[model samples]
Target: MKGRTFKHAMAAHCESGTLTALLNHAGLKISEPMVFGISGGIFFGYFESKKFPFPTFVVRSRPGQIRTALARRIGVKFAERRFRNPADGEKELDRLLSLQIPAACQTDFFYMNYLPGHVRVHINVHFVVVVEKRGEAYIISDCYSPELASLNRDSLMKARFAGGSFAPKGFLFYPVSVPEAIDFRKAVWKGIRSASFYMVKLPMPFLGVKGIRMFAQKVVDWPRLARDTEHLSHEIMKINIFLEDQGTGGAGFRFMYATFLREASELLNDRDLLEMSKRIMEIGDRWREISLFAARIGKRRDLGPDRLRELSGLIHERADAEEIFFKELLAMSKKKK
Candidate 1:
């Protein structure tokens, strides 16, 4: 197979984007927003562990759940594999590419040399599709990249085998089949319900809307945890990057989910959903404000307690808004049932 044969397109989030591309390549047309929404991809979680460099938070569901939940809901079959040895993984990927198949791979972002240096963090859950091989390089379609990119064999291997939290372990997957017909209406509602349930119903304090609250409460203590003022500023500015520029489709996926809701409303012809979609868009705007505020304060080196307290207040407000939003969404799900 020749390199660059697979069509490359950028998307909001890597996991859902890869799934959308695979499904489309298999002749099952679907939008990224639909895939994301139906997969229950929006979520929040706060973490402070010794393994991590500093306190952090997540704005989406656990890695790989999007594909798993999507397959179950939409009757798609994907062939998945994980390798204990990097050489074996490379051989398998080559075999697939030789057959003109595009395979999605899990890799640590730090080793994707195609990315800009500033964004090359050690996130292990980044997804990209290897389309073909040319000499010693693999042509890849990364949702984060605006166009097709190439990674050498050594860098690819290192990325696939990178150790730490959420290691890829040389994982790869491809869509084997998709059903001829699908019940999108049912799938949308189920997805919304699942997202709502995970957000509002999760018992853990550090997950879901509760997790947002924890983030709000803990952010005020970030100065104490940082190595210095500059460190605190960097972490604070990361809030903006995580929410907007990190392929979240803006506002930590609130905007994308709003798009999903609007699309679902049109498909289901439900006025209530249309209204809720508008509401969520407004909520996303508020989140954008928070991101901007964090960026501004951090860039200005305004790490005083008073500024952090103000930031905490903004997060707390978002938490309250999300709690109400998810609860109402859960109620709406019941009515749909």
Candidate 2:
């Protein structure tokens, strides 16, 4: 394997970062937030998964959706394939590399040696780019890693084939063709409209702003649902870590979305969206406060149901603010149209 002149940059989220690098390599020169927002990647979902010991909270759409949306919106032709055999997947990736194309693949972080031991988990939706192969090792650019790292072929295969939810199955994707020009305005409008629709029009109670409210209600009842103080503390810690420590760009992806909104505002010359962007940043701050409070509760282990209820009330306020904000955004977009 020879050196390829691909520019590798760090980013906040994996999928968005991978897309940003891929598009830049293809001469698009877009930022991560632009890729994220224009792909309608921001949203919320909360549910109890039997596969896990606790509930699940997600701040963005499921994996692969952002890549698909970004490709379609910007008129980039791409191909994604999942393999049943790991050897075949390796051959396919090598083929792409031979043609000077960087390939992005989904893998489990637990097998990535660059991550801290504590942070390594069996998360299979993590995405990374393979830029070059040096004999037995593959040079990878993982967004979450502090710097680029190399993994031996055996290690890369293990990460790609890790068994669990959202299993990678050696999935690989790359843009086949890119347009010379993109309809930025149309893409931005379509992206914003889709996000607004999901936030304001989604009927599921465990999605959008409604999901926040529902989760807050559940938080209020944690004492009654848990068997003891230890159980309640564990649950609080889990929620706090998921919101504050996960690769959400801080505050459960609210900060990232705020940045995207600010960028979109300038691109579209819409001051209203700019104001909303500031408001969303404030919301992200509020979310950080909630996480801090949860951490405190987890450590002290003395917060009663009434105290928990107060925290739940704060979350309710956040939900109310988000609900109003999304509705206003949708109305503003419609008026502009």
Candidate 3:
């Protein structure tokens, strides 16, 4: 542990980035997009509950699914553990660091002291790798940070044990083994097929492309939920942050998944996938346009009904495009299989 080095690199999202880093550290050279796509990371879900101060939407699959799907698709094994007692979690983390094992910990984003206060929130599913321990502080490799950061033992403990939805409960994982070789072709096709199925075939009305449409339909009603105009404006602006700045690599993971398709096309030598990659990239661009529009109108405090309807139209348009795009993708995957 003393002599070994853990390379730290910034990534678009926390879960995929941490997985890529751990896999790379374990001698498997893979890109973040490849990891994300192979894990079926792109998704959409609209949620309204008391758990949040305002209604929100998610642009990716559930946390921990990335690791689980990767293990199933590829022959990778991870050593994972969770603790009911916070003290035991800290002890196990220290033991892993002592053995030179860089452990990935799921903790609340709000407790990461290195981030700017404005950017921090109460998300309990954020992932960070503890590269090493130094006295009372641990060296952290957070995906969002440009450089390695440090977190005190007390802060780390609180983050790991944070109570709420998706509570981490001191969860941690690290790669234990990876196959000497990987079947990129089969993996890529399976990943793409699964993503398309989730988007177009899932039964849940509040998930996938249907969720996007629901968001469009329900957004006009948001004015009733807000405390005032400023609150409404702030929530609208958060759409931009969630889609771009909060780690979708831009366009709510559309851009990253597009990158994966391009890489998969080159690797598998499939011209159709290459063409699809271009199309998804265009779709991602449209999503970016929506985010920008939301940000601008929100900043201007233009929350009138007409403006809201225009925003809803923009979202619905994206949903239409995605429905067609994913169905085509599903057909392409079936043909390739």
For residues 1-337, could you state the per-residue lDDT of candidate 3 as single tens digits? Answer: 2346899999999999999999999889999999999988899999999988999999999999999999889889999999999989999999999988999999999999999999999999999999999999999999999999999989999999999999999999998889988888888889999999999999898899999999999999999999999999999999999999998999999999999999999999999988999999999999999999999999999999999999999999999999999999999989886
lDDT of each: 0.93, 0.85, 0.94
Q: Give the 10-residue window scoring lowest on summed lDDT in candidate 1.
A: 1-10
Pairs of colliding residues, candidate 3: none
Count clashes in each candidate, considering only residues at least 3 apart in sequence or on different chains: 0, 0, 0
Sequence-dependent TM-score of model 3: 0.98
Positional deviation of residue 25's Cα in model 1 after best superposition, in angstroms: 0.6
| Candidate 2 error regions (>4 Å) | 1-4, 223-231
How well is each residue in 94-124 modelled by candidate 2, as lDDT tens digits? 9988777799999998888877888787889
Please write out the lDDT profile of model 1 over residues 60-84, one tens digit for every residue: 9999999999999999999999999
Give the Å shift of residue 44 in candidate 1.
0.8
User: Can you tell me which runs of candidate 3 are displaced by over 4 Å?
Assistant: 1-3
TM-scores for all candidates: the values are 0.98, 0.94, 0.98
Off by over 4 Å in 1: 1-5
Q: Decide which is better by lDDT, 1 or 3.
A: 3
Better of 1 and 3 by TM-score: 3
